[model samples]
Target chain A: NAGVIQTPRHKVTGKGQEATLWCEPISGHSAVFWYRQTIVQGLEFLTYFRNQAPIDDSGMPKERFSAQMPNQSHSTLKIQSTQPQDSAVYLCASSLDSGTEVFFGKGTRLTVV
Target chain B: AQSVTQPDARVTVSEGASLQLRCKYSYSATPYLFWYVQYPRQGLQLLLKYYSGDPVVQGVNSFEAEFSKSNSSFHLQKASVHWSDSAVYFCALLNTGNYKYVFGAGTRLKVIA
Candidate 1:
């Protein structure tokens, strides 16, 4: 099924630049989730979408982070003015529904220098 | 606040030995619990989950987890481990009102031959 596909397995960006991570969910899946993982914070939920509609983004940073699911197949997470603190593994996951077992993609590692 | 705790940062076990990884969660109500494993350079995969009906849930690769509401614990176990089982294991919780899954810091398991 190709599972979930995340683009650009590794990304390096200059501080203050913008970074965009992509995720294509599994076929027939309806729920997509974004998370950030680091040595200090572990895994933190950033946002989630259901059926191409934003569900909850309470975990997203209030200012520089935003996410969008333009269609059922894919989603994007954008970080504006990326900083050193934004350097982490950005993971994308999807599920049949909110309560279903989620499948994850091999996250994109973001390095802000 | 909803959270998950995996006290062990890393664990080493001899191949063929029984394995047990601990997980504890904090939530006011019944929470959906899950165990996920991540191989090196790969995304997390569901090992097992427990919602209701069964205290012990069987998952792929002979993995199983027992959910205890009284103790607020959902621990993963395996009767016998193999070298291929080495990976980082994570415990997650999903609240009734939220779609984002709260995750623990993760326990890295190393099975030595």
Candidate 2:
């Protein structure tokens, strides 16, 4: 079975532009997670959704970062006014439910210039 | 605060040799432990996980991990290494009930022939 699916494996954006990343979780999975990976930060949790409902988003940036799971099938992470510091690989993962093993997508690498 | 630590930033081993990668976690109660591997230009994949029952868990590609509650550690091991085994290994802790998965900085493994 195909694991998680993320669109636009790589994206490039100009400074102050907006960038959106997409993630489609595996079928029947109940938990979707967004993480950012960088050479310096490694992996940082951004948000999570359970049963199409946002369960936690404490890791999201207070200002320009937002994530949404409008339905059970997919989720989106948007970064507005993207800066060079925002450049990183945005990883999307899904799990069967809480406390289960998670499967990750290839990730979308964002380059803000 | 909950955290996962992978002390070794990089570990190099000769081909056909045994391998071990260390991981430690900090949390209040029992937590789900996991090991994920990311190959070059690829997404993360589960190497193994420990939730309960057997302290030693086997995963794909002849990889295994042992959970030690006393030491607060979950370390990944392989009987013999192959060149294909070179990758970044991340240790993670799934917080009990909170649906938060914290990942370590990751250890980059290099198998030299």
Using TM-score as the measure, the top candidate is: 2
- TM values, all candidates: 0.96, 0.98
The clash count for each model shown is 0, 0
- In candidate 2, which residue pairs clash? none
Model 1 misplaced stretches (Cα beyond 4 Å): none
Pick by DockQ: which candidate is best? 2
lDDT of 2 by residue, A1-94 (tens): 7899999999999999999999999999999999999999899999999998988999999899999999999999999999999999999999
The per-prediction i-RMS, to one decimal, reads 0.8, 0.7
Q: Measured with DockQ on alpha carbons, how good is candidate 1?
A: 0.88
Tens-place lDDT per residue, model 2, B1-113, is 88999999999999999999999999889888999999987889988889899999999999999999999999999999999999999999988768789999999999999
Query: Using alpha carbons, what is the TM-score of model 1?
Result: 0.96
Clashes of 2: 0
**Lowest summed lDDT window (length 10), candidate 2 chain A:** A94-103
